[model samples]
Target: MNSIDKELLIKMYMNMVKIRRFEEKANELFLNGEIPGFVHLYIGEEAIATGVMFNLNTDDYITSTHRGHGHTISKGAELKPMMAEIMGKKTGYCHGKGGSMHIADFKVGMLGANGVVGGGFAIATGAALAAKLRGSKQVAVCFFGDGASNRGTFHESLNMASAWRLPVIFVCENNQYASTTPYRTTTSVENIADRAIGYSIPGVVANGNDVFDVYEVAKAAVERAREGGGPTLIEAKTYRIKGHFVGDPEMYRTKEEVNEHFENDDPIKNFKSQVLRRGELTDEEMDDIDKRVADEIKEAVEYGRKSPYPEPEEIYDDLYV
Candidate 1:
C-alpha cells in the first residue's frame, strides 16, 4: 500500500540477505582457521546498510566501519571477491593486502572500511568536500556507530560539511553498544541526531531494525543532499546481535537484552512479514531467496578456502602509492 515497487523492495531484501549470509560464512571461516584475521560480523546491522545503499549509485561514495561486510556487499561487490580477500587472494579488491578491516573497492565507490573507530568520518567528509568543489552531484555517506558520535573528528566532519555545504549524510547506527560498552553511558545527548543542531543541519531518528523505515528516511536525506541542501544526520536505532568481535564474550550485557532485540525486532524477520502480508511477495519467492543466498555463501566459502594467501612481495604492494 506504500506505492513501493515490489521488485525494488525485493531487491533491497536480497541485498540484506547477501550481507547476512556473507558475514555468517566469514564467522565460520575465521573460527575454522580459514580467514586469518580479526573478523567483525555485521549480524544485526544489515538493515542500515541495505536501507542506505538502496538509494546510492556508482558516483556516490560511502565510508565504512570495522563491521563492514554488510556495507561492501550492499554496494554491489561480488561475494566471491570479498571472501577471497579475507582469505588473502590476489584477486581480492585490495589484492588481499588489506584484509578484513582495511578492505576497499573504490571502483564501486566503497572508500574502504577503517579499523580505527572514527577514521572514516574525516575521509568521507573530505570526499564530500571534493565532490562539492568539483561541482559533482554525488553524495558521500559516512557510516559510524553511536560511540563514534563522541569522537572529535565526527564533530569536525559535521561542522565542515555544513559550512561548506557538502553533499553528505552522516548515518549513525546506534546499536545500543560499542564493543561491549553500552552507548547510553557514553553520550550525553538524548538523541545522536540532536548533535546536528550544533552545525545547523537536518537530523532524523528512525527505527533501524525496520529496513523500510531506514530506506524511506535515507532516500529523503540522499535526495536533499543531492539538491545542494548540505548534509543530514540520521541516527538509526538498532543493535548488534553477535559479539563485538569473534573473541568477545559480550559480558557487559545480558542474555535478556540480546534476546529481546534479536527475537523481537529482527530486520530480516520483520521484512519477511511485511512483504508477505502486503502481498508483495509469495512464500515461494521468499523461500527461493533464502535458497539462493545460502548457495551463494556456500560458493564463497569454497572460494575463500581455496584462495591463496598474499605472496611475500604482495605485502609491500598495497602499502605505498
Candidate 2:
C-alpha cells in the first residue's frame, strides 16, 4: 500500500464504485425492460478489472468476455456511451447493434466484448503478436471465466503465445460457476493458473476481491511482458453474486450461499472498509465519490434514454460481411 500512489488508489476505488453502481443500474433497467439483450452483470468482480487496468496505457489492448462492462469502464470508456450501448441506442459504441455483450471501443484498444465463451483468448493473443511484430511495447490482456479454461482456444492461444513469446496475459475470473454448472464439476485442474505450466509460462493466483493484491500481481505480469519475459496466466479467484444472466433462475445455488458472499466477499464493501481502516482514504472522501458516482449513473441513464435508436434503413450499415 505504501508503494502505491494515493491518487492511483483513489482512482481505483472510484472505478470500482463506478462499476458497482453501473451494474446495479443496468440490472434495474434490464428488469424494467429497458435493455434489449441478455445482460451478464459483473457485480462481484470489480476489483480485478480496476486493479489490472490501472497498470495499462491507453494503447494497451484487452479482449473482454460477456461480463465485460467493468473491464470497458476501467479501460477509460465513458459512462454515457457505455450506458447507451447497453440500452441499444444510436449513440452507443456499436450504434445500437451490439447490445449488452458486444460493445467495443477501438480508440481505447478494447477489442469487442465476445459473446462466445472463451472467445477472447485468440483475439488478445493475436493483438499481442501484432504489437510484437511491430516492435511495440504494448501488451494485451484476455479476460475470461473459469469455464473458458476448458476451451480449446484457451490451450491453443496459450501454446502459441508462449512459443512465440507474445506479450499477453491470460486472466481467468474464476467466479466459481460457468453459467449453471460449477467449474469444479467440469474442470479437471484444481487451479486454472496451473495450466500455464504446460505452456512454460508463469502461473499465479490472486485474491480477486482485493484490489491491492490484484494490482500487485498484474503490475509484475505487465512489467514482465513489457520487458520481453513472455506471457503470464493469472487466476483471479472471485465469486459471481448475481445469476449467469439478468433473469436466470439460478436453481443450482442456494440463496444462503449467495447472501453469505454478498455480505462477506463483496469487493466494493471490503475496499471501503480496508481503505478507511488504513487511513488511506477518509469516509468523507469516499462518501463524496459515492454521491458523484450515483449522479453519474443517473445522468448516463438519461443520456441513454434520450439517445436515438438506429433507423430501419441502416440494418447493414456497419456489417463487414
Candidate 3:
C-alpha cells in the first residue's frame, strides 16, 4: 500500500480521537441527566466516519443515520453547537429543536441524521441526482448500517442511482448487530457489499476498525463518484461496543464479547501503535492532540450548559406545514 501523507494521517487520527472523546463525553452527560433525548454512542465505529469524511470535500454531501455525531464532527460541525444541540439549547445547530438523532450542518454538507432506519438512502440519492443534473462534480455519501440494507429504500435508491449513474457512494457500517439483533440472522448475505452486485455496481469490503483501510477504500470510491463512475457499495466490518442507546440494558450480547472487541480491536489504540511504530508521528504530537481535544470537549460542555433553551413560542418557527 502506498504511504499516506503524514499530515493527512495525523489529521485522520485527530478526527478519530475527537469522535471518540465526544461520544465518551456525551455518554457521561447523558448518564448524568444533562443531555436530553436518546443518545446512540458511536464509541467503537470512529474509524469509518473519520476515514470516509477525510476523503470528502466540504461541498460533498453525506446523509447519516441516528448514530451520527461522529459523521457531523468529522464533516466539520462545531463541537459547541453540536453539544448544545444534544443538550437541547437554543444556540444549537437546529436551535435545539432537532436533538441527538437529527443534528445537521448543511454548511458542511451533513444532510441531517435520520431517526428512521434506512431513511438516508433516498435523501442521499436525491442529492447525487441534483448534483448530476446541475452538471457538478460533487458526490453524496449515504452512511447506513447493516439493518438498513433490508429496507426497500436501500434497494430503490441503489437501483435508481445505478440506472442513472448518479454520483453517490453507499457506505454500510456493518457493525455486526443491527440494534440488538445480530445482522447474521437478519441479513440474507454474508457481506452487505455483496448486495451491490444486484445493482451492477462495485462492491468492496474494508476493515472499519482500521482508519487506514477505510480511508483507502473510501478514497477510491469518492474519486470514482466524483469522476462520474457511479455509486460504490462499501461494507465496513466493525463492532458496536456500546449498547443501542445510552440506557440500554444490553441483554442481547455478552459482556465478554463486547470487552474482547473493546480491548483488542480498538481503532484509536491500534492506529496510534501503527503510526508510532512507523515514526509517522511522534508520541509528543499525539499527547498534545489528546490534551487539546480534552480541553475542547471541556469547553463544549460548558458552552452547551450555559446556552439557554429555546422559547416555547419558537416551537413552530423552523417547522414547515
State the lDDT of candidate 2 residue by residue for 1-321, as single tens digits.
Answer: 876878987898899999999999999999999998899999999999998999999999999999999999999999999999999999999898888799889999999899999999999999999999998999999999999999999999999999999999999999999988999999999899999899999999999998889999999999999989999999999999999999999999999999999899899888889988988889899899899999999999999999999899989796785
Give the deviation of candidate 3 from the true structure as CA RMSD.
Answer: 1.0
lDDT of each: 0.88, 0.94, 0.94
lDDT of 1: 0.88
**Where is model 2 poorest over a 10-residue stretch in terms of lDDT?**
1-10
Lowest lDDT block of 10, candidate 3: 1-10
Report the lDDT of model 1 for residue 99: 85
TM-score of 2: 0.99
Q: Which prediction has more favorable lDDT, 1 or 2?
A: 2
Give the poorly placed runs of model 1, Cα more than 4 Å off. Answer: 1-3
Residue 121 deviation, candidate 3, in Å?
A: 0.3
Candidate 1 lDDT, 1-321, residue by residue in tens: 373698888798888888888888788878888777799888888899999988999879999998888888988888888988888787777888788998888889999999999999999999998888898899999999998998999989999999988899999999888777888887898699998899999999988989989999999999999999999999999988989898787889888988988898889988989888878888888788889989999988787777777678765674667
Q: Cα lDDT for residue 148, model 2? A: 92
Q: Of 1 and 3, which scores higher on lDDT?
A: 3
Please count the clashing residue pairs in each candidate, in the order shown: 0, 0, 0
- lDDT (Cα, tens digit) per residue for candidate 3, span 271-319: 9999889888899999999999999999999999999999999988967
TM-scores for all predictions: 0.97, 0.99, 0.98
